[model samples]
Target chain A: MGKVLMKGNEVLAEAAVHADCRYYFGYPITPQSELVAYMARRLPEVGGLFLQAESEIAAINMVYGAASTGVRVMTSSSSPGFSLKQEGISYLVGSELPAVIVNIVRGGPGLGNIQPAQSDYFQVTKGGGHGDYHIPVLAPSTLQEIVDLTMDAFDIADKYRSPVIIMGDGMLGQMMEPVEFKEKVESKQFDKSWATTGTRGDGGPKIITSLELDADSLEKRNTLLQKKFAEMKEQEVRYETYCTEDADYIIVAYGTVARIAMNAINKARETGLKIGLIRPISLWPFPEKPFEETRKRVKGYISVEMSAGQMIEDVRLAVNGHAPVDFYGRTGGVVPTQEEIYEKIITVAGGLKYEHENGI
Target chain B: MLQEIIIAGFGGQGVMSMGQLIAYAGMIEEKNVSWLPSYGPEQRGGTANCAVVVSDQQVGSPLVSNPSAVIVLNNPSFDKFEPKVRPGGLLISNSSLVARKSEREDIKVIDIRATDLANELGNSRITNMILLGAFIEYSKFLSENSIIESLKKVLSEDKYHLIDINKRALRKGAELVAVF
Candidate 1:
């Protein structure tokens, strides 16, 4: 297949369809509206269902219902819209339903304008919907990675029987880039034995509910869920590191900000700063291995973000006092410029001697 | 090499499509390309802009903080983005809409009367095409054939009839830059 220029939202929708996600329930929201719009146009052609529900709340419950029927299902929304879906997400988690939810993040504490921001990192990777559990989330920076991860979200969802979140932002959702959809690996296949598919005439009864009256049984279930989460954390960690082999300083970022950091890293490298970037692809799994490995060697870590400071905490958690973790951030939709980030890098490494840092 | 560009104008002035065409053309030529629009409440009215990156290698960031070239179809965009052009970059403004020269002395500026030229060509809608053609010619970093090929991919079939006029506008643009 040849590469075609496509917007991030549309490509993500197509990748979902390619992953055999036959049902989509979503309400329109800025930035990610194109995903729902594309599904409305493309899903029916592939014999899939596209439903525009009354509200974000309605849409996520619809996803829960469809996913319980053993069908691949999804829902997408931007920041304000996504907040309304939180209750439904928690319910899906409690039920262990395999579903893909997309949050094309926009600026916000409260309808904080319709611009791109990564403020939802904590809400998404941590528990947004009142739960003691965390969900696996993929934050893809580029359109091509969006394709790979959107498709992977389904497999990961089904494999773990948990909702997978694709954490994108308006910058990624609205950007157009050259992408070639990969030939799917046959969705990896699933039995879905616990599905609520219609009962055969004489088949035994089955129930699909997250409500458990007994405290003991619920605790047992929670323990099993914890085990599965542990497995996912060990098996599904994904991340990318650039120029980190022999670095004196490293930058930690994800999604759109990570790409901006890369441009800054390149400029900083030109003027003799031993800098690198660690971009986490899977936000929940968090990819701590790189941080653990690089901690003893690097002088400090710069955590850059579009929010006031959400992901920086994760970087700190991973670094664990091994090095100084500095933060640079912008909130409410203002993107950081490369020059400013480059200047920040120079500031971080200004007093350190380059030759001694390299141990020459 | 990477060409980081910003194309800006009012909503009806084809700013978004101009950015898309550049991205599509870059893809057709087998180069890495990205198009990022300036999206906010302003998109509901007033000015619109998009950043385009066409590079020999994968683009690190689609957001162009400083552009190698800028195409402003209205006075406001010219007023806004002219100062952000990289020192040795290029500026192509719609002289028909904007009445001032660039305030910067470090960069090259091309004052193409794209709106007037398109009107002379019997299609005011082709004003953006005229500007795109001039950018390609003046930059000489990309070719006209690549853009003509991209139109077929980007435009709907119903609009295919306008390809001839668009081609002419492009040619007229290229011709303008040749003698300037």
Candidate 2:
């Protein structure tokens, strides 16, 4: 198909449609409202369902109901809206229903501002809901990547029979770029025989419930979920490395921050600094393997983000004391510039020599 | 090659559309393009801006800090972004609205009477098209034909009638800049 310039949120909505996702339920929220608006206009054209729930809570529940019917379903919201849907998300996970939840994140501790932010990193990757469960989180850096990952999110959600989160910031949601909607992604289809799609002609009525009053049954369920999570960690760690072959310093970032870090890395390299970047595409399965491999060659690591420092904790854990990890970030809707990131890298690289000389 | 531009103006001045046009034209020319608008509560009646990046390679950041070029339509926008233009960059200002001229010695500043030209074309809203015309002429980032084609795509079918006036504004702006 020919390339069409589209906003990030609109492209994601289109990608979901192209991926055969028919059921969409969402509440209006800034940064992500366009996704819902696009779905509202386009889904009906394909004889698909588009619903705008009264609230984020109601919307996520609709996703749960639709997903249980063996239909490709999704719900989108911003940071606060995502928080409202956390309970529903947990229920979806516990019930083992496959659904795609998109969080086009805006700044927040609570109604902070309506601007792009990566502050929801912890909320997304560490299970925002109250329960022992994990959702595969995909963080896309570019508009095209958002389209590709939105399609992949559905397949991944269906593959594991779990809820998948597409974590993007307001920047990713609003920016417009050229995109080509290719053919639907071909993947192994999940067996929906277990789905609660009514008992007419089926062997028995499928029960889709997250409630387990028995302790032993609940423990077993937890064990099975943990096993699936471990499998995902082994199988689904997506990341990208730039100019790390002979680099002494590596900056780790994700989503929009990763793109800015790339520009900083390029600028630093021009000044003879051996700087590289590690961008985590799959934020949940945090691409720890790359850090393990690069720890030997790299001097230190810098974690840059739009938040104060959320992903830096993961970076430090991944580096495992092999290298000193520093962080540079902006909080409350402030985006860091490449020049600021470049300066931070230079300062961090300078400190590395001091630490070596002190030997303590 | 990468061309990073910032288009700034009042809310209803079509600043966002101007940025979108450049980005769409870049796409038609087979280049990677990203257009990011300054979105928030301030988007209503306040100073609005958008960053447009056209590159042969994938654009890293949609936000342009020190842009290679800046198009300012009003006084506040000109004041805010004039100093942010990179050295040896281009600054296209609407002289009819922004009374002050950019004092930057390093960058090339071209002041076009975009609003006045659009008014002469019988539509004041096409002032953005006039500024876009001057930008294309000064930068040569995209062809005039490509921009006209992009306008057809960007404008809705109902607004197709305004295309002729917009094209005229674009040409007049280009010709005005050519005289200098």
Candidate 3:
């Protein structure tokens, strides 16, 4: 694969085409609007369907309709629009549908700035839509990963028969990077046996619904879904580790903040901090194994994120009280620089204990 | 490795399209690449920027602060980014955008009237292509043949004959900057 520069949003759109994604339904949203624009122009060239639905709700439902046919389908939105898609996402999960949903997050508790923000951390990881279901989430920091992960999302969704989200912030979506679209893998088609397509002579049309009125049957399906999710946790944890072997501080972060932490670790290495970074490439499965390993040697851990502190809880859970856990962050679309992270490292390592003062 | 760059300008000036072309060249040369634009609210009314990075190493941080090189199409961008260029980097400024004299002596500054050249060529939209031409020539990471091949690949499908003009724009920019 050769280098071609593309915006993160545009790359997702192009990769979707290359992945043989047949249907795309999305509304215009900041930081992710380019994705829809790219799909609008390119989908027709590939003989695919691209629809700008009336609303985010309609868009996600459109994706639901398309995914039911067992074809590659996708929808993307920014923070607020993504919020609107949650209901559909829950439905997608309940139905065990395979679809790729993208959340190019922006600053917000509600309708925040258009700039980048990871505030949707809990919303995305804790199941933003509803119910007790978990969605497979991939957090990409760079543009290359955006393309790679979009294609991977489709694969993971199908493998688990669930909705997979490539959760990126505005910065990741808006930034451009040189990405080589390698010879695309052959689009793996499903058996259509379980798809809601009209049945053959053996049975009538298959009904695809999230609702299971039968209590026993719903439990059985939930058990199956839970089993699939458990399998994903074992098989689908993705992370990147930098200079942790002899490090005293292990900084844990994911998505965009993780990139900055890596840079901070590099800078701190020169100053003899012996800092390392554990970046969760896959946020939901949450990459617990590495943190469990690093907890023994590392003196303390700080979970850095753009949001107030969402993934920090997962880090503490992963470490299981083995090491001192702390949290430091900036919200409302402010990206913490390497210097800020370095300062936090010093603060955490300097015996400043992180008591659970704020419950959230 | 991936090198990403953001090329920004107003909508009609072809800044965004040129970004796509440069990225395409990079792809033809077999490097991992992505092209992102400032869309929605930010891009609706005002300056537009496209980030482009071409690199031989796996791209880690895609947000380019102090870019390797800057091709400024207007004064606001020049004022905004002139000081940010790393030492010994090229600052390709469209003379129309940057009328102010450069204060830095260490950096290479090429003043090209890309819009004027495009107007002279009977199409103002080719300025971005011209700038891309200069970028390719100065950078040398991508060759003319590869760029042309990529151009043909992007343009041939549309049966558009205007690629010859874009090729001319690319060559002129390359020729103007070769001696510098």
Q: For model 3, what is the error of residue B79's alpha carbon versus the real structure, in angstroms, after optimal superposition?
A: 2.1
- In angstroms, give how far residue A135 of model 2 lies from its true place: 0.7
| Model 1 lDDT tens row, B1-180 | 899999999998999999999988888878889999998877454999999999998788889978999999999999999999999999999999998898788999888999998899998999999999999999887789989898998788998998999999999888988876
Candidate 2 local lDDT, A117-165, one digit each (tens): 9999999989999999888999999888888898889999989999999
Tell me the tens digit of each residue's lDDT in model 3 across A1-360: 666656678888888887778789999988889899999999998899899999999999998898888988999999999999999999999988899999999989788878888998888889997788888889988776777888888888888788998889987887666677888656776566788777677887787899988999989988988898889889999999988899898888888788768766776788777888888999889998888788988877888988888998898889887887778898988778666887777766654544543322
Every model: iRMSD:
0.8, 0.6, 3.6
Taking candidate 3, what TM-score does its chain B reach relative to the real chain B?
0.88
| Segments of candidate 3 deviating more than 4 angstroms | A1-7, A10-21, A37-51, A65-72, A142-148, A174-228, A260-264, A267-273, A325-330, A334-360, B1-8, B18-36, B43-45, B112-150, B153-180
lDDT score of residue A169 within candidate 2: 95
**Residue-level lDDT tens digits of model 1 in A75-169:** 99999999999999999999999999999999899988889999999999888997678899999999999888988899999999999999999
Question: Which candidate comes out best when scored by DockQ?
Answer: 2
Model 1, A299: alpha-carbon shift in Å?
0.2
Using TM-score as the measure, name the better of candidate 1 and candidate 3. 1
Worst 10 residues of 2 chain A by lDDT: A351-360
Better of 2 and 3 by DockQ: 2
